[model samples]
Target: MRLMLLIRLIFLLLLNGVVLSYAHAASLAYEFSRVSNNSTEDLGRQLSMLVTEQSGGALFTFSNRLGVPSSITDIYFDDASQPLFSSIAYHSDSGAGVSFDSQAAPANLPGGNVIGFLAGFSGDSSAQSVEGGVATKGVMKNGVNSTDEWVSFLGLWANAGSFDGLIKAFADAHFRVGLHVQAIGLAGRSDSYVNQPSPVPLPAAAWLFASALFGFIVIANRRKV
Candidate 1:
C-alpha cells in the first residue's frame, strides 16, 4: 500500500510539472495581417478590435517603429496628419544602427509590404542600416548594430515589436494605413519599420495546471498520513 501511494504521488507530481511546463511554453501569439489603402485610424480600429478580441476585452498597448521620420509621418497615405496619441516614452534598443529609406524601391513603404526593425528604437547613428535587403537584426546589445547579415525583413518581423504607435501616427498624419497581421508576440522590441512581439505568461491553462497540482499535493499528503 505504501509503495502504491509513493508511485501515485510521484506520478501526480510529474503530471503537474508537465502541465505547467506546457502552459509556460505556450506563448502569446498575435494574429497579424497586412492593411492596404486604409487610413491610420482604420488600422488602429482594426488593431484595437483585434486586441479586444484576443485579450478578451482588455485595454492593450499599441506602438509603431519607423526607420525614417517621414515613413512614420508620410507613406501610409497621401495626406499629412497627426497621430491620435503621442508615442509613449520607451527606451530604444542600443547596440546596432537602424534606419529606413522610403525612396528605395522594392523596400519602399506600401500597402502590403511587411518589415521588421530592431527592438528599442534607441541606437547609434552609424550602425549599418537594416535596409537594402539585409533583414533580421540579431540580438541588439550595447548600442552596437551586430545583426546577422543573412536574415530578411520577414524574419525580423518574427521577433519585432508591434508598430501600434507608428500606425496611430500615420493615421494622425491623415494617411491611410492598412496592414495584415500575421502573429503577435507577448514580448519583443520595436523600431520604425518593424514591430516585435514580446514574451508573456500563459493564459488560464497555467492557473488550471496550478490548481490541479495543489489538489494533487493535498490528496497525496492525506494518503501518506
Candidate 2:
C-alpha cells in the first residue's frame, strides 16, 4: 500500500511539472524594431508608422510625403522575413489617386479583426498626394520564445509596369520606400532571441519538490514496514 501511494505521489509531481512547463511555453511575449522615420533625409521619399505599446490592437496612421506616388505593399506578422499578409496600392487613372487591395483574410490571424482605413490622397485629394493609412489585427500578448510575436510594414514608391517593374524601380531615385513597426503586448524577451539548444532546463523548484516528496515516501514506507 505504501509503494502504491509512493507511485501516485511521483505521478502527481511529474504531472505538475508538465503543467508548469506548458504555462511557460504559452506565456505570450513579443519584440520589434523601432520604426526608422526617414522622410526628412529623402525629402518625402520615406516615412514610418507605429503600432505603439499602449494600443492593444488599434490601427496606426501612415503617410506618403514624397510628391511622387507611393503606397504600402505588404504587412508581415510574427516573422519580419516572412509576410503573413500583403496588399496592393496604386494611384487610379481617374478617381482617387490611391487604392488598396488588402489580402487580409482573417483566417490567417489567430483571432480578432483585420482593420484598415485610407486617408490623405486616398481619402481627400491627390494633388500633393500626401495620404496613406494603417491596419492591424489580433490581441498581441506578452512573453518570449514560443510566446514572442510581432508585425512589420513594407511600402513602395513610384512603382509602375509589372511586378518586375516595381523591382527595377527599386533601384531608381524616384522609387522610394519606408518602414514602420512596433512590438505590442507584454512579457519580456530580446528581439534577436532564437531557440536555445535543447534538453530544456528543469526549474529548480521542480527538483526541490521532487526531492521532498521522495523523502516523505521513504519515511512512510519505513513506518509501514
Candidate 3:
C-alpha cells in the first residue's frame, strides 16, 4: 500500500507539473486580452462572410502573466470554427526568443476543434505564415530565447480588411474559444480555459427586474448570514 501510494503521489506531481504550466499561464488568468484588429486581406469580394460575422469569433491575444520570468515554449488555441491567422505585423514588449510555429490540428481537443501550435519560443523561431488555415512556421533563424511576462500571440480571427476580409468564411464555434498555454519552464505544466461570449445586453425593464431580484437575494443571504 505504501509503495502504491508513493507511485500515485509521484504521478500526481508529474501531472501537476504539466497542467500547472497552463494554470499559471491562463495568460495570468485573463485567458486572452482583446487586441486591435489585424490587417485583413483584400479579396475584392469576400468569399466568406465570417470575416465580419459576430459568430465568427473576434481577434484576441494570449499573453503571459509570469512567462517573462520563466521560459516559454509554445501557444495553442482550440476552435471548431477553423480559425484563420496572419503574419506578425506588430510587436511591442513581446517575447523576443520566440517565433510562430505551424498551425496544427488538435490531437486531444474536444468538439472537433482544431489546434494551432506555435512552438520554439525560447530559441530563434522560424518564420511564420498562414496558409490553408494555418500560420507561418519556419526553422530557427537566430532566436535569443528572450522571455517576458508581456509575451503574447494573436488569436488571429476578425481579420476582415480592405480585401473584403478573407477569401473564405469560417464558421466559428458560436463565439467560444479554448485558449491553452502549454509546455513552459522545466515542469511543462499546462492549463485550458473556455471563453464564453458575453451575454447580450438586456432591455431596461429586464435590467430593473434583475436588479430587484438581486436585491432580494442579497437580503436573504444577509439574513442567513
Q: Write the per-residue lDDT of candidate 3 for residues 84-164, one digit (tens) a residue.
A: 433321122244434544342333322212234222111112456344455545432111122332333333333542111
Query: How does residue 137 of candidate 2 score in lDDT?
Result: 22
Number of backbone-clashing residue pairs for each candidate, in the order shown: 61, 6, 19
Give residue 106's error in model 2 in angstroms.
24
For candidate 2, lDDT tens digit of each residue in 137-225? Answer: 22111100011121232333222223333323323312222222113113211111111112123345466567767876786778778
Top-lDDT structure, candidate number: 3
lDDT of 1 by residue, 1-225 (tens): 878877887888788788766544432322223334232222221231112211111122222322111112111212123322222121222222334222222233343333321121111222234544664342232121212211111101112223443333333433232222211222222222212233234356667876887887788788767
Q: After superposition on all CA atoms, what RMSD does each candidate show versus the true structure?
A: 14.6, 18.2, 20.3
Error of 1 at 195 (Å): 4.9
Alpha-carbon lDDT of model 2: 0.29
Candidate 3 stretches greater than 4 Å from native: 1-59, 67-95, 105-173, 184-187, 196-225
Off by over 4 Å in 1: 24-195, 221-225
lDDT of model number 1: 0.31
User: Model 1, poorest ten-residue lDDT window?
Assistant: 149-158
Clashes of 3: 19
